[model samples]
Target: MKLLILGGTEFVGRAVVEAALGRGWEVTVFHRGRHAPPAGVRSLHGDRTTGPEGLAALATGSWDAVVDTWSGAPSAVRDAARLLADRVGRYAYVSSRSVYSWPPAAGLAEDGPLVEGSPDAGDVPYAESKMGGELAATAAFGAERTLHVRAGLIIGPYENIGRLPWWLGRVARGGTVLAPGPRSLPLQYVDARDLAEWTLDAVAAGLSGPYNLVSPPGHTTMGELLDACVRVTGADVELRWAEPEAVLAAGLEPWSELPVWLPPGEMYDAMHTADVSRAVAAGLRCRPVEETVADTWAWLESIGGVAPRRPDRPEVGLSPEREADFLAKYDPAGGDR
Candidate 1:
């Protein structure tokens, strides 16, 4: 199979390229030279933000599939899809559940309403841009030829987003780690490799439509996830469970600074609780959480930490000072640890 992947050198895109290579598919990656393409894949350099001339290199070749991981402007996505409509058999756009309206309720189905409208390539909002990408793909390739892989928080190796890495790093640090509670808080995420393999298989099988690509709900809890982190990293640590309200009261932000954590009774509680039965039935198998944790920890150790890679400023994950202050005060009501 001849596959074309846009932005195939980072996180989720990298996983897809690797998975496709393992399957012995002919993969060509079209991306800006910000990063090198994987060793074996053919690389074409171009900026998606540029107009016709930017995409001119891709105009000549045909591909069996195109997997787009674009998170910016709908116009760019529309132009690309329009260009590739006749050149590719399938267009798989990696969209996020954020494309759905916020405060998603429990048991939200894939058929639920999606965000609408186009966005400027510059000054693009993440959610609206994704929604625009979906529309662009469908509009150009038509429903029969497009697949929208709507994913939730993607985890596993090479994840630079700092969600899983932050957890793994914090847990590996040992001693009085403040964990978000209740400990049973359900979390859902899919390994990037799993999503890639499933997406490829679906394309090959002529499967089309939106699939909520996340691990099945209740597959693991926050506590179980942390335990896996500790086991994989061999941390001689004790996790001090902090109630969500308490953590919030202590001035800790949910999801951003905490990474992969959400407070109870918050509207975002439903973000991680999305229904993913369709993807599972369609052969989306997830590896063990421990495996994901272990491999990710190994990658972190090899890189020597996130700071070097993100030198300008590490965006996600809490600061040591902030964590120390929160840990120093044990009681949610403001007592000492």
Candidate 2:
């Protein structure tokens, strides 16, 4: 199968490219030629934002599938879809759970309402722009030829961005760690490889429409998540509850401040849970969490301090007085701390 992937140089796109290549699929990547393509993959260079030159390059080429991970704006996706609708058998657009409206109640499914906005939402336009892009692709190719994979926080090896690695690195150092909220708060993440595998299966099976790519239903709390990090890295870190506002007041930026924290929200309050039964039933199997954690640690070690260790002193276990002080300053209402 010939697969053309847009923005396949890094993160999710790169993971998809790797998975496709492992399956022995002929993969071609379209980007600005900024980064080197993965080994054995051909690279095509052009700017999708400025003109039709990039689309024109693939105008005559036919592919079994096209996975779009880079088109942030709706117009960009619309342009691409118009060009590839007849050229490809299936078109997959990488979207986000951010498209869903805030306050994601438990047990929410893919049929939930979505947020609406333009392609550019200030600094990072990927989420909102992808929402618009999904609409355009669906319109261009129709449901039969299009599939939207709305992914949640993707965690796995080589995650240069601060998702799981940020907290893991912090805890590995053995100090008081600032947790957003309670230990049992909902936390969900999907390994990038798992996502890529499922996406490929979806294309191969000719699955269409929207599907939520998230972890299986289970309770993954803030504490458990941190504890797992500590266990893997052997970092001696203490847990400290800090309100969102207090975290800002202390001049400590939330994880969202980091460029890698794409989905902007408190990990505790921002519940991005979704039901992926449809995708799983269609042959999407996820790796165990332990494997993900081990792989992540291995990748971090391989990088060798690419992620700088925070200079702050290790936070010893919070004392009663400290806990009280933290609650008073951060969570006056005592709401789920």
- Give the TM-score of each candidate: 0.94, 0.79
Least well predicted 10-residue stretch by lDDT in candidate 2: 308-317
Candidate models: Cα lDDT each: 0.85, 0.71
- Estimate candidate 1's RMSD in Å: 2.2
Tens-digit per-residue lDDT, 1-337, candidate 2: 8999987887688899999999999999988876777898988777887756656676778899999985455778878888888888899998877777766655668888777765323223555777887887888889899999988778787564556776666667666655764445556678999999999988998999988887776635555666677788877666676545554554443445321221225443344456778777878787777778777888788888344222322322323354345445554354434
- Model 2 segments beyond 4 Å from truth? 117-127, 239-270, 307-337
In TM-score terms, candidate 1 sits at 0.94
